[model samples]
Target: MVDSIRQYLSWYGFLFSLGLALVWVLMRIAAIARADVSRYFVDRLMLWISIGVVFGGRLGYVVLYEPEEFLAHPVRILSLDAGGMSFHGGLIGASLAVFLLGRASGYSLWALADIASSSAPIGLLCGRIGNFMNGEMYGPPTTLPWGVVFPSPGPERRHPTQLYEMLTEGVLLLVLLYPLNFSSWSRRHLGSLFGLFLIFYALVRIAIEPLRADNWNYQLAGVAVTAGQIYSLPMIAVGLVILGRSLSAARLRDRV
Candidate 1:
């Protein structure tokens, strides 16, 4: 069943693009329900976010993962056909777009961020599933019963880290955040959901880093730490700061 699905996905390049489309739809729905924003605003926001995700994800992958190669062939930066994207980069780009749009539209930045964050897990889920279908992002060898034998890495059974992320970062996150998005308290606190999203995603990525095989070259000073883990540390810290500030502001408002 899994192989058949993978073959189907391979036959047509739909899963990743489908994921983006779903994300856009989810965001638009969220904007209407949560913010009651106009159609024009939603359309504009989606456009900016799409641009951010593509350019930012590509640039991030180039700079962080393969700077030397990209520098040697700079034109390859525009060639997304080669397939490299960084989630962290996309998050940064999307956040920037949200911030900019919020400023221009006179909407609350935190509120817009909350809406995006709430819908982000859907994208993560789809992207990880796409990775699984493509047989990429498999983890190190494992003797576990459920371990999968991916095509590129040759016969040894490996932990399906993409599926792991699909569960933790995608399914779990969506379950956790989606309800909070509709909660009165979360709405009042504004960026609380976004803060939690960051903290949870970073923690999960850090936890899953040890299982992944591709980050060996990015290990830190002979330690087992991968670049993803290193990048995630800041996310955790920032999440904590944002969560704290949002809660504090909410409390202050309540007291007034």
Candidate 2:
């Protein structure tokens, strides 16, 4: 089984399957909740989102982590797999894609956001697993029994922060949001689920900041900051604003 799997398995293949599954599952959930997204529009949305994530993630990584390298060879941005991709970048790209898709397709923006947000955990789960397999996002050295000695990083036992994120942002988030997808309240609340997604994701990421931040920590002046925390802070504020506005709107509608 291991030999056969090795022959056929590639990171790209796994990613493609996961991306397709994420979109398909999202459409199904939206249908279950009766979102206004059409089958035709979704097909286009998926295509655009795939392109956006790949391009944006790569660009984000270069811009944020390796500006010098980018300045040295601007054309290197064209290489999707030249190095690690950034989630923050992918998020920006996906958001733009969703906005464009929603506008062009005449679908409800919040509805698309809600569906996309909920289904994102599926992709996160896959992405985190990919990170683990690639030996890129492991945490600091650990004495814990479950820590893995990644081939690329070293022989030191490090926390599997990638798996930690999979559990927190992927599994737990899915469980939390699954119920909302079926609710009459959720449908009316519009951006509520999306808002909650951003909030929950930020919270979870911050929680794991210490773990994943080991390799990617940044220091400025005299302070240390994790890249995840930096990106997540603004998102938390954005989530709060969204939730606040959504609740206020819901309240007004209730009075009507």
Candidate 3:
């Protein structure tokens, strides 16, 4: 048991917790560093949301797909350093925290969502790179020149899908959202840019997942399609709904 535990921790620990910690610290610093909405209250709210994200993400991952693994070693669930987390779970957690915090702060949820969305990609990029370093979430086998040879489970040339996601969902997402700053869409609808960010990233993620390596975590329409894809569907749907609603509202406001 000791050797098994040691091996598991050695293989899957460090990067997991460190990635989250770094992101969390950066987010808080960014919030405080910014003059736009810097306030004690805002900082407090962000703290609460961060707590929610960490807790919710861990619990959600276990509940959603790895109940047995977590249940067998209940303590390990809290050991994020041992890895095994779901981005979808973290998103849900963050969203829930944002909603609750927004309400408590007497702020529009959409506006807060927009702010959260704006700075999110940078943090995501960091996390994905961490994922790559940890050799956790990698892509399927590939003969491409850019394919990376992840050193875990089995050594083979695989798509560095996580990095692809980091660029698209993180860096590219930020670039796409930047236009909102000058466009009337952002000022008018507030969350319109954020909505587009979500939709765009989810769409890109759907495409990226196919290239990812097949693992036990992958699952599909009651079958198996990869956990990454399965988790992205709802985000795509929600983003679409938000985008559609925001557009209609903008149109109505313009007519008025």
Shift of residue 220 alpha carbon in model 3, Å: 5.5
TM-score quality measure for candidate 1: 0.90
- Give stretches of model 1 more than 4 Å off: 1-13, 78-83, 217-222
Candidate 2: where are CA atoms >4 Å away?
Answer: 1-9, 78-82, 220-222
Clashing pairs in 1: none
Which candidate would rank higher by lDDT, 1 or 3? 1
In model 1, what lDDT does residue 191 have? 89
Residues 1-256 of candidate 2: C-alpha lDDT, one tens digit per residue: 3443343246744864685577666766565566556666667777787788877887889987778987998876655455557888888988898998788777788888887788778788888887777676788889999999998767899999989998988899988985787778777788888899999999998888878734467785677878778888889999999888888998999999
RMSD of each: 4.1, 4.1, 3.9
Tell me which of candidates 2 and 3 scores higher on lDDT: 2
Error of 3 at 103 (Å): 0.9
The clash count for each model shown is 0, 0, 9
lDDT of 1 by residue, 1-256 (tens): 4454446457224766777788778778776667545646777887888888878887888887779888898877666544458888898899988888889998788887887788889888988887887787789899999999999899999999999999999999999997775567777888898999999999999998787777744546777677778878999999999999999999999999
| Two-way TM-score contest, 2 vs 3, winner | 2
lDDT of each: 0.82, 0.78, 0.69
Top-down TM-score ranking: 1, 2, 3
Compute the lDDT of residue 165 as modeled in candidate 2.
93
Considering only N, C-alpha and C atoms within 3 Å, which residue pairs clash in candidate 2?
none
